[model samples]
Target: MSSRRLVVMRHAKAEQDGPTDFERPLASRGRRDAEAAGAWLASQGVAPDHALVSAALRTQQTWESVASGAGWTLSPDFDRGLYAAGPESALDIVRLVPDSASVLVVIGHNPTMAVLAQLLDDGSADAEVGASMAGDFPTSAVAVFSYDGAWADLGEGTARLEAFHVGRA
Candidate 1:
């Protein structure tokens, strides 16, 4: 089986009072949640080989907090396209990942993240994993998928949901 891991994360909680959505940063709760999620990833030995993050301030802050806590060594890529991307756009970014990488993480917003998770998951026993993701990829949530083929070939049934975790639950 191919060993490709995709870790998708939703940015942590942000101040609702911000002047604009893009300028909002993580809240205190968001900081704690991000740290918790990051520590969990570290405990699972799931350090990402590469990270692609949305350019939004909240998303960027979430990535930085998690990466710092995870002690990640890889430099992350900031992609503006990921900010409010749809499932196809998310898949497009994933398809660009080099097969040489064993793990890749994408940190972005919701609705899209939820949709992408559903698109990638096959109706296997792991359907529950996808269901969990559907419940809502709230702030500081991470969903993990294992693809049984090359990154370039990733799509639909080619990927299987492995785990879904959220900061609060």
Candidate 2:
């Protein structure tokens, strides 16, 4: 089976407003961090085939900044299900990715994203990064995992954390 690459990230900081959480805007720091994350990916020569983004305003804006900074031209799929969705929902979204895509990116919230990275980590790679991930998956942090199996077959402890990155713009 071909190896698969998954990049999971939580949306950056957002303004604390009460109008509605879904409409919360990304804070200035969040915008900077998101752009820095994109630049970091570009520096690392990372190009994901597809991006499954959360439909919330903050998440969408996060992907927008990241894509612009990274020079990614691919259209992203924004899904409402990802807004406040748990790890299981996130996994379900990933499972829907076409097999033709070798690399996939997921941008959403946490502790779902954070916990999912921990739960899915096989610990066979990037042990140190995985360990740090346990403490905090701060805003704009990105975790890369390599899984061997169909997306449908991904389960707990089935993927190995390959790399983790956090940057400033």
- Candidate No. with top lDDT: 2
Query: Cα lDDT of all candidates, in order?
Result: 0.82, 0.86
Candidate 1: list runs displaced more than 4 Å: 126-131
lDDT of 2 at 133: 74
lDDT of 1 by residue, 74-143 (tens): 7889999998789899889888987788889999988888788778877663666667876766778888
- The list of candidate 2 runs beyond 4 A from truth reads none
Model 2, span 1-169: residue lDDT tens? 8888888898887899836999999998889999889888877777989899999999999998898878898789999999968998888888888888888889999888897888788878765776777778988989888888888888899998888887567
TM-score (C-alpha, index-matched) for candidate 1: 0.91
Please give the lDDT score at residue 85 for candidate 1: 87
Error of 1 at 16 (Å): 1.0
Tell me the lDDT of model 2 at 35. Answer: 89
Candidate that scores best on TM-score: 2
